[model samples]
Target: MATAAVFLDRDGVINKDKGYVSQIDDFEFIDGSIEAMQLLKAHGYLLVVITNQSGIARGYYTEEEFMTLTEWMDWSLADRGVDLDGIYYCPHHPGKGIGDYKQDCLCRKPNTGMLDSAGKELDIDFANSYLVGDKLSDIQAGQKLQLKANYLVSTGKVLCEKGAEAADGVFTDLLSVAKAIVNG
Candidate 1:
């Protein structure tokens, strides 16, 4: 039997999109995020967080700091009965990256590298899975893999624009999207 997942874009979908959230103190969850995650998990969707951490490549923050915040977020979610099956991120910026981080890597969102990584590592049924993101890049990333559904939340840069056309659904936030996923 194949497994299905709900791929989430971390920055805006999981937490606030106040730019690069590197510090623990700066981290904050969106309202109903924990409950939504738990609901998805209860519905048998393996929660996978896929984010693009350009701050890591831009020298704005170190990968260690990113990892630290991520670990803290993971535990925070776990406390609420939302255990993520996987977390993947990209730390590359072709132009803004510094030194080793400077490169046009395929793992970046809108490239599908991260989705491919998750698909290969897990029993992900891409054609039957769902992706919820706050950016156009996130939609393009999963759509490239033929995901069952793609949703864009009105919480990031893509808002106020016609990003709705790119997604299967558009909502005020992830919780609304999760509601449809869990109930539908």
Candidate 2:
């Protein structure tokens, strides 16, 4: 009775990582990402965005700014006929955080905090879920949760060392992964 999900990393995977994007003007979707998402939806996969918004912790941006941008993105996607199931973000960084945000938390990627929370709340089947990330921590997070597959994308920061080993496969972008998912 559990539904399958596609865990997505915000920066590099969903939107262009324009250096801690906190403003709507800075947020840009990767080409074809919206179309790919439509395909995923048609195939019946719940879409969840799990991101690390360390800018909030580092005092680079306020929580309100982040929320505003998030709302814009979600609304824009909705206009394109794609509605995300859940959007979860961790505003923490152990070293760089200024105040209460400074802590080593399990919600960060490579840990399964965000993923586990979404699964419990959204009825996701972890073993059947898939993850698409550009960083090694993203792949590690899905691996720790033992998802069906984890893909490393060429966009974003593109962690190459340990991430390659952790990833189930590497792709040019999210659209290619979408095609593979729809066809596979």
Candidate 3:
């Protein structure tokens, strides 16, 4: 009787991907994103955020900044009656990262480390879960874990047409993805 979750990518999926948006002013939730999250939450879906934070490794921002932003984002979501179960991010880049972040890490997307961790802590049934992201790496990660569903949204780096080819389904944005998950 394990729980299942909806893994989400932060950038583009949550907010606009305006390039390393570490500032509060730059953070903007996509249209209907909050309502979508609320719907998912109401349906007993555990919301988990899995993101690749190369900005920290690239020296564009610090982990503390990232944490601050997460706090704000979480608070905002809570305001809209959406509560997230957990959030995981990888600061490693393997090539473009600086110092310790330059090396490969298991928590990075395209790998199942974060999902594995969540499975352990949240009792997530990977085969019964879903992942929504705007990149191939996100789809790759979901496939790696053999998740029940993988959704690619066209609101980010990967367009819907392109992501649709690789994902279980393509969505216009997080809101659409949310609706599909709740009502599908």
On TM-score, the candidate that comes out on top is 2
1-184: candidate 2 lDDT, tens digit per residue: 8999999999999888888999988999998889989999999999999999999999999999999999999999999999999999999998999889999999988788999999999999988899999999999899898899999888788467778777899998899999998788
TM-score winner, 1 or 3 = 1
The C-alpha stretches of model 3 lying farther than 4 A from their native spots are: 160-162
User: Residue by residue across 18-110, what tens digits does model 3's lDDT show?
Assistant: 999888999999887788788888889899999999999999999999999999999999988989999988888899999998988898889
Model 2: how far residue 91 lies from native, Å: 0.2
Relative to the true structure, candidate 2 reaches a TM of 0.98
What does candidate 1's lDDT look like per residue over 16-129, in tens digits? 888999999998898887888998899899899999999999999999999999999999998888899999999999999999899999999899988888888988998889
Which sections of candidate 2 miss by over 4 Å? none
Residue 120, model 2, lDDT: 95
Candidate order (lDDT): 2, 1, 3
Per-prediction backbone clash count = 0, 0, 0
lDDT of each: 0.89, 0.92, 0.89
As for model 1, its CA RMSD to the true structure in angstroms is 1.0
